[model samples]
Every structure is written in structure tokens, then in C-alpha cells.
Target: MKRPHLIVDDEIAVQELVGHWAFRAHTTPIQIFNRATDPFLPGVKTHLFRSLEALDGRGFRNPVLVITRWKIEPSDVDRLEALTNLKLTILVTWSGIDDDRVEPVSSAIAVGSLEVLANSASRVKKILYWRPIISGLNDTNDHFASARRLSEFADATVFTGLFYREEIRAYFREAGVPDLYADVARRKILPRDAERRILSHFEGRPIFRKTSCGVAFAHGVPDFNGHFGIREICDICPEAQHEICGRKHHRPDMEVVRSLARVVSLADLDGIEISDRRIEVSGSSEAQRYFMQHALNFQVHDRAQPHRQHRHGRAEIGWE
Candidate 1:
């Protein structure tokens, strides 16, 4: 959370928005939520099911990412399994953080949901989304062991760090939680050593650095985010997936980038540079950038946020 923000859950508005978004979705390889709450909650599952049912009825074949940390019953599996068109992936978030101020819900809930899905949900893909793995918190050897045991029940596992923004810092400060990062960062606050330890702990497990990479691996496809160009990020990627992504990694022609830029209204087409790994552009919104990235299946970078050599989307806090 960047700031104390007010959220209004307008069901009609969201349904209309999803309809319009799906109406406009023509082969954009991925549709991420882009959801306010945990979709599998009792209060929210109806909407989640209804929306996916509608999308499947419309025969949309793109991958639909369902991010949740709540419970998933066998009925939920049954309903989701009935959907035949869309490639549905449920990303179950678990941090293994003990601090109640940071996370009120127990990670055991996620563990139960993952086990349920692993046993019954064959049509749907499940991922143990081990995240917010801050140092001196959930990055211990025991935490890794717990996550490793949990990972056996998942199609794949993706680990990363926190979005320690100003608002979160203030919240933690008032809650008596220790300061996480040196300061607020636009990118996530995952240190290099933390990442290294996680990699070493997992060894050759189906672990990934990026959510897209995990989803891609689960589906037997290349990363829709095109992370293969950033080879450092793929250091822990499974060997088969490395080859899959490598085969699919091709730089887009400049004319193609220009045409898509025009479509997305990226005015500075001249500033768009086709690099070996990522497409660099001067001015573009996140939505616009993601649209182009999915359309081309390549990484798109904005000039405002320069990616460092080893750090993909992380802050420079601990890397120094």
C-alpha cells in the first residue's frame, strides 16, 4: 500500500469492468487481477466463480490468474474444474511470517487450501506463492523447510519480497514492527543475499523468481513476461523451462513495437528501443507496458525505472 487509500467494492461496476475488459481482450496472452480482495473468500467466491464461468462461456483461452490466500473447498475445485476454455491458475499466497501486525491470517489457511487443491483440482494449476520473505523473519532454514514441504503439493512455487512503501512503513511503525527496509522503495524490497539463500535452500525445486515464470512453467509454456532475456533471473529456473523460454525468446521487429506503441498511445515511439532482452520505452503506463509485454511476450522497460544488472524488479536497499 503506497498510502492510506479508500476502497469501494462496487459489484455492478466490477462486473461491468470485467465484461468490458473481456470484450476488449483479443489475444493478450495474460489477464492478471488486476482483484481487490482474496477471491476465494466466502463473501467473494460467488463473484469469482461467476466471472470465470462467464469468461469460459465466452471461450476465452488466455491464462486467468486468480490470486488468493483464503480457503478453497472441494466444491470450489469442482466449479473451477468445469471450466474448459481458460487456463486458470490459483496463486495461493503464504509468507510464513509470525508477526500478527504484518499478517493476521495464519499461513496454515493457505497450507490447507493448497493441499485441498493439490488433491482434487487436476484441471486447475496451483502455486505456493511464498512471498514477503524478509530477512530475520521468514527466511530462516526452518521457514525454508516448511515452504519446501508445502511446495510438494504445488504445481510450482514462486518466492519474492515485500512492497515496503511509506504507508506500510507507517503502519508497521505504529504496530511496533521493526523497520523492514532502509526506506520506501518503488520496487519490492528483496535483498540479494535473501534471494541467494532461498535459491540454495530450494536447490533444484520448481522455484521461480517471477510470478509469470511460475505460471508459465506450470502450463508448459514460455514466460509471458519474457524474463529469459534477463538470464540472471532464470538462474534457478528448471532446465526444461530454460530451453522452453529460450526457444520462444525472440526480439520483436521495431515496426511491430511502433505499431503496438501507437495502439497503446505511447506517444514517444522514437524513444522505444528494441534491446536484446527488453523493450525500452520513455513514456508508458503500467497497463500499456503490460499490454505490449503480453502482446509480444517480451519484457518491456520504462526509462523512468532502469533495471540493474542482477536486480530485476527489486529495490537497491540490501544489494549495496
Candidate 2:
């Protein structure tokens, strides 16, 4: 089994990515804590915390691939770094050249968090810079400035193409950022020229471009061992860099299935069959189908397991 992917953010999409990777890696499901309602699967090696504050009281022994946003403070990072066993990767998104011009969602305070991580004693393994392309707003010369600034700190940068969503459209209008928001109000994909122009800014920088979530930035982690959904484009996924899927078969470990079965039963799911490395749920309700599908695809750790209970001292405990 490989190191478990530890996701520390609240983004459902990112949580799902790590969960998918856990199944593909044939390891325990990604342990996630978004500071919200508890995630499914409470008996296996997977875990979901009520909040980021809960982690201060817990410890992990395995070399976990820690994926988190740059929202944590230096003090929090210091404590996390104290756990020498875990590997850390910080993800941050920016739109403007600096904090002052960026959106409140990507503000100076948020950028300060990145700086805090960089200065912290934790020695973060990787820093992935994310730039969500927004036309006229961040797609101008300002994009180059942001990319250049990113090169100063990040190991790699991922440029995510913007998509049209009602919330996003409404956000730009409500935020009072003109032109750019209106430009993207109806459009989804960033124009080819705009993408090229933004990308060109990082031409000579150490931080190169790969359009994706931060996963493509991982250096030691195997790409095939994980999964990316529609975001699994060649330029973004490191697995595509080596062609792991074509060369090797990625079969789910039966133990993972068995572990997930416990979650299935707990979810009150019936008509679920596990065989031949495949899970089939017959004549199930929509909620049951959703439960079973997510359970199988993600980590299913038992938070109530005595061994995984909170420990304050240096005695590192395994999530398993």
C-alpha cells in the first residue's frame, strides 16, 4: 500500500480527487477533514475530521501525502511539521499580481498564509501555484506578474481554465469587477491566445506550467497510483507524463473492497455485490447508489477505531 492522501481542504472536487486516487493506488482511502459534516466511512483506514482544529489533537504515523490549501497559520504549520514522518504539499490560488489587487477570495491575507508556510519550520515538500483564468480581470499583463511572483515560491504552477457557472458569473457581477466578469459571464473556456499569453509569462522561470489541480506538481508520488476525473489532461497529470495506465494495470485491492463493504453495510445499502475486482449494486435507491459509489471510490477509515483516537504526545499512531 502507498501513502494515504491526506486532504485538508473543503473543496468537494479536491476531496473526490484524493478519494479516487486512494482507490487507484490500492492504498487506504484519502483521509479528509473539511471542517464540515462528517464524510462517509467511519470504520476503515479513512478519516474525516469535523474541522481543521481537530487535527491539532491527532497524529499520523504513515508518510502521508498531505494536500492542503494555504489557509493555515504558521503556528499550525509548525505543529504539523513537527510530525517529521508526513510529507507536505501546499496549494494556493492567485489572480492578481499581488495581494492588493486580488479578489477577497484570493486576497493578501490568503497570500500571507502562503508566506507563512514558506517561512514555517515545516519545510513543505512542494508548493503548487494555481491561477484560475478570468478574462480581462486576471488574463492581462497582471497574469504575468502573478506567475512571476509564483515562480519565486512555488515548485510548479497550474493554470486552471475558467468555466461558466451561475455562482461564478454572479460572483463577478456582485463583486463589482467590470469588463472581465462580463466577458466571462457567458464564456467558459479561456481563449487559446489568452492561455498562451498567460503561459508565456513563466517562460524562463523554474516554476513551469501544467494546467490542473496541484497533483501534477507531485515529484515522488506515482501518478498511475491515483486518478483524476475530467481534469486528467496530458499537460496537467504527471501520470500522463510517464504513461502509467498504458504500461501497468490499476486494479483495486480486494482488501479495499472488503473494507468498503463495511461502510456499505453501515450505510444500510443492500443488493451490493463484490466480485472480480468490481462492485455491482443492484436495484438500489439513488441515495444508496450514491453512498455505495462514493464509499468504494474513496477512503473508508473508521474514526471511532480506538487506535485512531486523538493523541497529544509524540507517539505517532497509524490511521489503519
- The lDDT of each candidate is 0.84, 0.42
Residue 137, candidate 1: C-alpha displacement in angstroms: 1.4
Model 1 shows how many backbone clashes? Answer: 0
In the range 1-320, model 1's lDDT, one tens digit per residue, is: 11222243445544565565423453555433334556776766776787778777767777789987788998899999999988889999999997888888788999999999999988799999998888788889899989999999999999989998999899999999989766899889888888888888888689998999999999898887899998899988889999999999999999999998888889999888988889999878898898788888899999898899898789999898
Per-residue C-alpha lDDT of model 2 across residues 222-252, encoded as one tens digit per residue = 3322222212233333444345423332344
* TM-score of each model, in listed order: 0.92, 0.50
Regions more than 4 Å wrong, model 1: 1-26, 29-35
In candidate 1, where is summed lDDT lowest over 10 consecutive residues?
Answer: 1-10
Highest TM-score model number: 1
Best by lDDT: 1
What lDDT would candidate 1 get against the real structure? 0.84
Alpha-carbon lDDT of model 2? 0.42
For model 1, give the RMSD to the true fold.
3.2
